[model samples]
Target: MTVLASSAPVLEVSALTRAFGGLVAVNVIDLAVHSGEIVGLLGPNGSGKTTALNLISGVLRPDSGTIRFAGQAINGMPAHRIARLGLARTFQLVRVLKGMSCAENVKAGLVFHRPPLSRGEIDESVDRLLRHVGLSDRGGLPAAGLTYIDCKRLELARALALKPRLLLLDEWLAGLNPSELLIGIELIRSLKEEGLSILLVEHVMDAIRSLCDRCVVMNSGRRIAEGRPDEVLADPAVIEAYLGVSPGVSTDA
Candidate 1:
């Protein structure tokens, strides 16, 4: 796998801003993901993590500022268009085609890729992806029948089918048990090893510390701190915003 230096960012957001009515969801946030880095996005609930992912993936348009991927300005582009440019994301709330089989749902994802594959190729790719996500035996099952963790894996397989250069994962570890979390972490690590740039929004600190080379902390729609995961997590601002206590202040009675 090719290692990405910090200077070569594959996804760049500069002064990005988004708002709904009077509520500013993302306020002039600037972020970047280098070609092979897994950057963690950390914040308390409603700190604009999902909103930022939406903007980056084109699920929502920014009210101001620029979003560029692979050197192309993608601001205002439709979600499909952005996805076709090799950017893909998984939702916080898993979304699968309830009526479709697992293989069919994965097939739907391959439709957006350039130079469409033949039927046989698509089928083969679907099988391979299902195996990669540990759903090889369940390919014929209806996605709706799968458990919550299986749904997350299905979504991940679907995202991988897009053959993305950059992936935004929103709370993918939220509902997983310890063993499931280990599998998820290993899968993500393997993807990163294959040179995929990932932006992870997760509440699991252990996962963040294990998977991320760096982290950005957000609060009230603004970035509060950004640095190495350990450093950022230890920042007084981050502690206060996330834990509601000033760093170094004892809570002991």
Candidate 2:
């Protein structure tokens, strides 16, 4: 796969902050994902990783900040509008249309495309996407009947149906078994190889190590560090934030 050499970022967030009542969920976070880059967003629970994704994806409006995608300011834009611009995301929890067949669920995501696909084209695209996500034979099955891993796969197919330039993956690797985790990692790498920029929010340390070109560490709704994965993971602030102890201190002390 050929990587684009464009200097402009595919997604950019500056001083992004969001608050719910008196609680600040995300605070002054600046992030960027350039074309063909897979960046990991890592932090402990309640550290605002998912919240940051929501703000960037238009699920929640930022209280203060600017979000630019493909050179257009997208802050406060409706979710569907942002999606039409090639920014798509998967939820931390697998969400599928329980009543719809797997293929139908994927077809629903295509509703927003500009040129409007014909019936035959839509069917062909749906089949190809289901096959891509390893759900080729399950297209006729109701989505509710899929196992947890299959449900995740279905969500991925649906996201791909949008033909996004940038994909935000929130905890897509959370509940997979060892083998399933390996498959998930390979799938992400393949997407990256195809020139899809990704912002990944994941708890699996091994997957993060294998998939991320750069890592951003967050804690208490703030960005603590951003650098190469090995460097960020070894930073004193990241270690203390994740382990709740100083780097040199013994936990048993």
Candidate 3:
């Protein structure tokens, strides 16, 4: 895979803002994500992390902003159109067809706004994706029967079926146990090694600290800081906004 140059951002957002009525859900925010890197977006609930992802993935239109992916404007493009442009995102909510088999569910992703392929091709493609996500043997099972963690993995696999240049993931580890969290983290790491750029919105501190090369913290619809994991996590502003004060942690913000 061809790696992207550091100077040229794979995704860029300038002055992104979204509002509903009199309330601003996301204020003017600017961000740039380079290829082959994982950048975490974290904050308290309603901090606009998911909203930011929605805007980038074209699920919701930004009230004012410019989003350029690979040098092309995609701010107002529909979600399906964005996917065709090598961007794909997974929802915070698990969106699986309960009655469908795992293989069938994965196949759905491949057909997202794309021309249909032959059955044999779809099967081969889905099987390869399932294997990549460590779900090869589970493909024949119904989606509803899989455990919560497996379901999450299935979602990741489906997202990868798009062969995206950039992926926006929203809080995928929400309901997972410790073991599941580790597995999920490992899978994300593997993807990064495969040269996929990622922007993840997650609250799990451990995952963010371990998986992301850098992070951006948001609070009340505004950016607080952006830097390496340790530097950003240790920032007084981030700790105050998310972790709250403790006797041992710094109180100044």
Among the numbered candidates, top lDDT falls to 1
> What are the per-residue Cα lDDT tens digits for candidate 1 across 41-65?
9999999999999999999999999
lDDT for position 120 in model 1? 93
Runs with alpha carbons beyond 4 Å of true place in candidate 3? 1-5, 113-117, 244-253
User: Lowest-lDDT window of 10 residues in candidate 1?
Assistant: 1-10
Error of 2 at 167 (Å): 0.2
Candidate 2 vs 3: which has more lDDT:
2
Order the candidates by TM-score, highest first. 2, 1, 3
lDDT of 3 at 27: 94
Cα lDDT tens digits, model 2, 71-114, are 99999999989999989899998899999999999999888655
The alpha-carbon deviation from the true structure for residue 8 of candidate 2, after best TM-score superposition, in angstroms, is: 2.4
Per-residue alpha-carbon lDDT of candidate 3 for residues 105-211, written as tens digits (9 for 90 to 100): 88888886255678888888898899998898888999999887788888888898888989998998788889888988988888888889999998888999888
Which lDDT values do the candidates have, in the order given? 0.93, 0.91, 0.87
In model 1, which regions exceed 4 Å deviation?
Answer: 1-6, 250-253
User: Which has the better TM-score: candidate 1, or candidate 3?
Assistant: 1
Q: Clashing residue pairs, candidate 1?
A: none
Structural RMSD, model 2: 1.2
